[model samples]
Every structure is written in structure tokens, then in C-alpha cells.
Target chain A: MRHYEDIAVGERVELGSYTVTKAEIREFAEQYDPQPIHVDEAAARESVYGGLIASGWHTAAVCMRLLSEGFLNETASMGSPGLDELRWLAPVRPGDTLSASVEILDTRPSESREDRGYVKNRLVGRNQEGDDVISWEATNIIGRRP
Target chain B: MRHYEDIAVGERVELGSYTVTKAEIREFAEQYDPQPIHVDEAAARESVYGGLIASGWHTAAVCMRLLSEGFLNETASMGSPGLDELRWLAPVRPGDTLSASVEILDTRPSESREDRGYVKNRLVGRNQEGDDVISWEATNIIGRRP
Candidate 1:
């Protein structure tokens, strides 16, 4: 188990691989996005993206999956206040394998609270080709055990 | 039909409303996020957030829906180059009606090309209760009519 005490500033955590599937991307886009470039392959071929592409929101959602399966499973995580920045650096296509890394940037207890602390981390998601897909910083409130 | 040649700076586009639902939020959480606060209302009630809350990505997805159904539907848009910022200021719950507004900050055409241009815009989303739920800035490549 990863207690608040176990995490250090500048520490890096490598999240394992995640694959992007046409079915998954299509499902997500159909429900939330429904953009031609994201859901319809033939239309995507004629669109500006040049091919079917995963929605940027889908890319970020996959990154969140990595965060959960890799880091949150072992940590005493409360929840994040929110993200500060979210950038879709490049398009994600079906069949790409996504890997991620997180860096601890800052940690501090709430000024008014003793048992709860916050950790700021920079999360980066990359494709199998070593290209960045999404990058953002997340601020999470965690519980500190006495 | 709205052509890409017409979207000018300082223009404001009002996208329609999106209604949040517990089922949609839960399904999104199950597939990608699965955070306690996002997946289980009971667990969420015990958390610091004190109630069932949608995932931040879920909120962003709703904002995207508003953009697609209204703004994108009216414009000859290619695709975004990227997003500059995304701030999730508050939680969104079931039954929240999300409305969005886009401010075109700048527009620049490809100097060497005749068929494409870029637009920078600030997109803000508000919940039914009049709370700012999300704010983001993005750059998209728009198409020009022949």
C-alpha cells in the first residue's frame, strides 16, 4: 500500500501499456462525441483528420484509466481537486498502445486541515511510437495517516 | 450553411444544453475511470465531495456534445490542433443542464495555403445552477469553401 508518506517529490511512476481499439473509440464517440472523424471510418477518410481518430476526450479518459489501474490501486487517494492543464498533443488512432508516466511535483497539507494533504502531479500519456498523446497536471487531495 | 470563411474573431457561439444522467456517468466511469466518487453514489457520499459527482472527463464530454451539436454543426470545421487549457472548477451531477459559449479569440489563415485556416477560441461551460463547470481554450483548423 502506498501511503501519503511513501510518495516523494519528483518521483516517477510508469503506468503499463493500454491499447486503443476501434470498438472502444467508436463506442465512446458514438455516445459522447459522435463526430464523423471519430465514429465513421469512410467519412473520416474524407475529413480533415485524414482518417478515423479517437476523440481528444477519449484520449484523456484512457489516461485516467492508467492512473486508476497503476497508481490509485495502492495509494490512499482521496480525490483530485481537478486538473490544471489538458493538452492533446497528437491524434490517437485505433491500434495504438498507450503508456503513461506521472511525476510528483508538489505535496503539502491543507493549511486548515491536519489529516488531509494534497499532491500535484504531471501526468503524461504516450503512444507506442513514442509520441506524446496527452499531458496534464493533476492536483489530488489525499489522506495522510498518522 | 455557415462557411469557414465567416467565423471571425470576437464572435460568440452559444451551444445548446446537455442534460447529465447517472447512467451515463456510471457507464463512463466503469469503462475508463471507475473512481469511487464517480462510480458509486454511496461511496461518493462518504467522500469529501459529499455526494455523487460526475467524472471531470465526463463533464468535458458533455461540453464537447454541446460544441458538436450547435457550433460544429453550424461551421465548416476541420479539427482542433490542440487545447491550451482545461479547468474543471466544480462537480457536475445528474440532472445538471450544461450550456456552453465560445469566444473566438483569433483567426489566422495559412499564409501559403488557400484552403485552410486556424481559429483560437475560449470555451466555457456552465451548469444548470449557473456555476462555471469547465473552461478551456482550443485551436482548430477550419476549412475554406472553394
Candidate 2:
């Protein structure tokens, strides 16, 4: 398992991928972002998007899943204070396979706590066509080895 | 329905609330976050949080739900290109009620497209004790009145 000290700045890692589906997008929209463009295919076709699209939040959640499966599970992740930015540059449609790349931008030991440190990462998600779908910068607090 | 022009700058609106539950937290973590502090209760108890806590992404999703239910449903929201920032200030625990307030920070007609406009909002979420738990600034593209 990787601890806080094991992370090196400027290192990049390839996270896994997820293929989005119409059902999952609709279900997620129904619960959290029930906009017409996100939920109703017919209405979406009539809207500006010309068809159904996933919520930006849904794409973010997919990125989170990739991050967890790729690295957070094997590390002493405490939690995150939050994210610096989130940009959905392209529409995510059904059948779009999304993969993520994470770059460790910075790391520092917590001044207020001895057993913990922070690692900042720039996470970028791209579609099968290599078009950028989502990007964000997040800082996670990880435990230091005793 | 609120059109793009209907959104006024500096207007603060109540965006409603959500009550976090342990079951829901674990369910979300299992699917999207899957960290020990978020999914495994026993391991979370031994972690830095001392108990289970909701994932920051989950809290952001809740905020999105509130934003949709409170305002986006009534507006001509095309979708958002991105968000400027996000911060998870405190741990959201089971039974903790989260309420959100949104302030329109800025609004302007889209320069590139005459059919749309841009609205910027600073959204803040607070727990039952009035402690801020999540906060973010988002920019939404809204359709202009035809």
C-alpha cells in the first residue's frame, strides 16, 4: 500500500476507464440532476444538445470511481478538502468510453498534523476519440507512515 | 420559467436541503468513491475521521441536486461548460442535514452565441449547525429569450 511519503510530485499515472450508458446517465440525472438534456431523450433531441448528454456531475463521479480503483484504495487516503476546478469541455454521450490520467502536481506534509500530508493531483478525462471531457485539480489528505 | 435575463446578479436564493444517511453514503461510496473512510465503517472508525464520512464528490452531487431542484429546472439552462471552484469544508455524517444557498455573482449575454448567456453563481452548502460543508462557484450557459 502506498502512503503519503510514497507519492512523488510530477509523476503521472494512467487510471482506468468506464463506458457510460444511457440507463446509468438517465438514472443519475433522475436522482441528482434531472434536467431535460440529461434525463429525457426526446426532450434532449429537441434541445440545444440535439441529443441526450450526461450531467457534468456524473462525469465527475466516473472520474472519482477511476481514481479510487486505480490508487486511493491502495493508499492511506483520509479524505479531500475539495477540488480547485472542474471543467467539462465536451459532451459525454452514451457509449463514450471515458479514461482518466492523474498527475501528481504537488505534495506537502501538513503543518497542523504530524501523521498526515496532502497530495495535489490534476485529473483529466478523455473520451475514446481523445477529446477532453472533464478536468479537475483535487487535493487529498493521506496518512504518513508511522 | 426563468429565462437567462431573469437571473439577476447578487440575488441570493435558498436552494433547499438534503439529509445524508449512512446507507446512502455507503452506497455512493461503493459505486463511485470506495475509500475505506467512505465505504467501510469499521475501517473508517480506525481512520483519521474516526468514523464514516461522506465522500466529497457525494456532497458535490447533493449540491447539484439542490441546484437543479431549486432553480435549474425552472430556467432555460442549456448546460454548464465548467465550474470555477469546489471545496468540502467539513465531513458530512449520517443524519446530517445539508442546506444550500446560491448567490448570482455575475451574468452576461454570450459573446460568441446570440442565443445564450452566461450566469455565474457562488453556491454554499451548510450543515444543520450552520457550519459550511461545501462551497463552489459555477458558470452556467442559459438560453436567451427568443
Which candidate number has the best DockQ?
2
What does candidate 1's lDDT look like per residue over B38-143, in tens digits? 8888889998789878888888888888887778756777777567567788888887888999999998888987898888899999988889988888887777
Model 1 chain A is weakest, by summed lDDT over 10 consecutive residues, at A78-87
The CAPRI class of candidate 2 is high
In model 2, which residue pairs have backbone atoms overlapping below 3 Å?
none
Quote the lDDT for A28 in model 1: 85
- Report the Cα lDDT for residue A42, model 2: 96
lDDT, candidate 2, residue A41? 92
TM-score of each: 0.90, 0.98
lDDT of 2 by residue, B1-146 (tens): 88898889999989999999999899988988988889989998887789999988889898899999898999999999888679889899988999999999999998989999999999999999999999999999988889
Span of ten consecutive residues with least summed lDDT in model 2 chain A: A76-85
Off by over 4 Å in 2: none
